[model samples]
Target: MKAVVIGGGIAGLLAARVLTESFDDVVVLERDKLSDEPEYRAGVPQGRHVHGLLVRGGEIMEGLFPGLRDELVRSGAHLMDAGEMRILNPLGWVASGRSGMPLLVVSRPLLETHIRRRVTAKIVDDAHVTGLTFRGSTVDGVLTRDGRIDADLVVDASGRSSKLPAWLAEAGIAVPEPEVVDSRTGYATRLYTAPPEIPVVVAESLSAPDTPRGGIVMRIEGDRVMVTAQGAGGDHPPRDPEGFQQFLDSLRGPIAGMLADAEPVTPVYLFARTASRRIAFEQVTGWPGGLVAIGDAVCVFNPVYGQGMTVAAMAALLFRRHSDFSAKGCRDFQRKVAKTAQGSWVLSSNADQSWAGVEKTPAPLMRAFRWYMKKWQVALVHDQDIFLRFLRVVHLVASPATLMNPVVFRRLAKYSRLDPRPGRRRAARSPR
Candidate 1:
């Protein structure tokens, strides 16, 4: 069997890698010209920004491509314990300790390059997939500028810009309107040579409702660090160097002072498309056979939560586990994919609701959840166990329900008296 995967990005490459195990031939179609070396491409506009491989994501990728973590470290990527990273939440700084979760800090291009190199499938660059080719009710292939490429199966990993919905509509399939929640988040990022004086490996001050500004500084490959200044609820970081630095200085953390004298290696790059959107393909009537969508094609999360890549990895793993390719089987797989994304969608969309100007008001349950989460953040400040549980949930290693355990409820009740004011902590003095 032949499988055609559209978009040679991380999702597409990963899907192709998984397809190689079952399909006799697998081909990936990417619009941009991919190079052997790690470099930014136009297709991934946010490639220059700071990216994190969650502990669960790293574990999944390592399983798909063994020794991937070691290879990255060998190429200068930093492998550090996740708990060591300094994080300023809405309340205060989370206590630091070893959480047993390993974080692999690497550039997007580097990670993509390594994954692409490991994939045994054929990857065709500069190939633009316009639409799908249907054999009656089943999607048999994809249409490209060159010609029709037939396949027994077609996987859509075209990301947020995917045209699968339109293609299905044209084929008389009724697709449901995608659920969307936007916080109007924007990012301005720049790369800098790692200065000897900078002692932090990864530091972040997350944006909150009261304080819309946030910043992150993390070490990546090439002995360099990436600094991203971000804002939410329409407070966007400026693209100009002076303005960018000023924005950094406005953050609640010490990232600005840490990078005060660092030499910049790249110009400021701005990315503003951080909305959370989910296409409910499983809800569509008459879903086509021999077709599946993964990654951003199905759901796109706010990059601020650092959930997109991890969710994509989880979806690809779901695809790998699915064995049936019949019409009903395809529908079942799509439903499974949707189920897998539900947790992340909840985490990110609910968080975005905290920003001002969001149209969607939280339900009573969500409101209570948010209230509890605020107390949980306060608890995280001095409780290493709570911090580790939060880390595990965010990393996709544990269920969100774990945070609602009786132990956590008791902890929150204890910390309830210490209702730390939001965004009131003094600027972080130094990285832990």
Candidate 2:
């Protein structure tokens, strides 16, 4: 069978790579003129920001491209044990513990190009897929600007800006209406030089309550560190030199101090239109035969959580699990892929909802639970087990349900009483 993958981003490449293992021919059509070197383009605007390959993605990527982690490390991406990394939550500084998994930090562009180069599929750059060239209802091939190429299947990995839906409608198929959860967020990222000879320290600092700000400092391929400071709900960080530093200083922890001391490399890169969006492709009726969508094309999350590429990579794994890649397979594949994407989707949704000005308020019980969790987050500062469970959930290794278990509740109760609030001093009885 032949497979034509539209869009050569991480998702498309992953789809093509996996398809190659099962199909005779796989062609990837990328709209942008892909560079042999690592660089950003107009198509992928998120490249300018900090991107992380979560521990889950790292495992899948290595399976797809052997020695990928080592190559990434050789190219300059640092591997920091996610549990050992410094994280400042709304509560306080929680001590890092061993989760036996680490995250690979690299520039978004490098990660894409690295995966693209490794895939052996025929990549046609500077090609826009105009539409689909189908016979009756079965998709036989794609309609590119140049001409048509026959294929057994087509995968739409075109990202959140994908035109596949319009192309499908033009082909006389029902276009899927996606559900979106928009949280008007913005980000300002700048590259800085790490102080002389200091090993890169990956740090994430959160801005709580009054300020919905967060930032990440990690060493990428170059000898420089990438620092991204982001604010939600229209609280844009200024591009001016002094204001940027002030924004950093307002963060929860030592990141502001580190940035205050570190030298600047790249100018502050600011990005906006950061919203959580999910395309419910599975709900669409008679979607299409021999065609499927993956990656940000299916779901685009707020970049604040850094799950875009990882979730996309995970989607590829789901796609590969399906034995069939035909028309019925495409629809079935979407339903199956939803299960894999649901975890990260819920993870990001909950975190995004934490900020003020977020439109979608949870139910009364959930709102109360979030308030209680906030207190637990504060209590987690002195509780190692709570901290570990929180990190595990954030990393996607564990579910959000794990945190609500009775054992975790008992631990939190003990910590809350022992380390009472600044003004109050009371001990609550432990749960039986």
Per-residue CA lDDT of model 2 for 260-296, tens digit only, reads: 5678877888888678877777877777678788888
In candidate 1, which residue ranges exceed 4 Å CA deviation? 423-425
Cα RMSD of predicted structure 2: 4.6
**Best-fitting candidate, measured by lDDT?**
1
lDDT per residue as tens, model 1, 1-432: 999999998889888888899899999999999899999999999899988788888999999999999999998788888887878776667887898888888889999999999999999999999899888878899999999999999999999899999988888898999888999999999999998766445455554577788878888888788888888999999999999988887776778888767899999999999999998898777888899999999999989888888888888887667878767888999999899899999988888877878855778998897787778778888798888888899899999989877998887788889856776655657435
Q: Point to the candidate with the largest TM-score.
A: 1
* lDDT, residue 265, candidate 2: 79
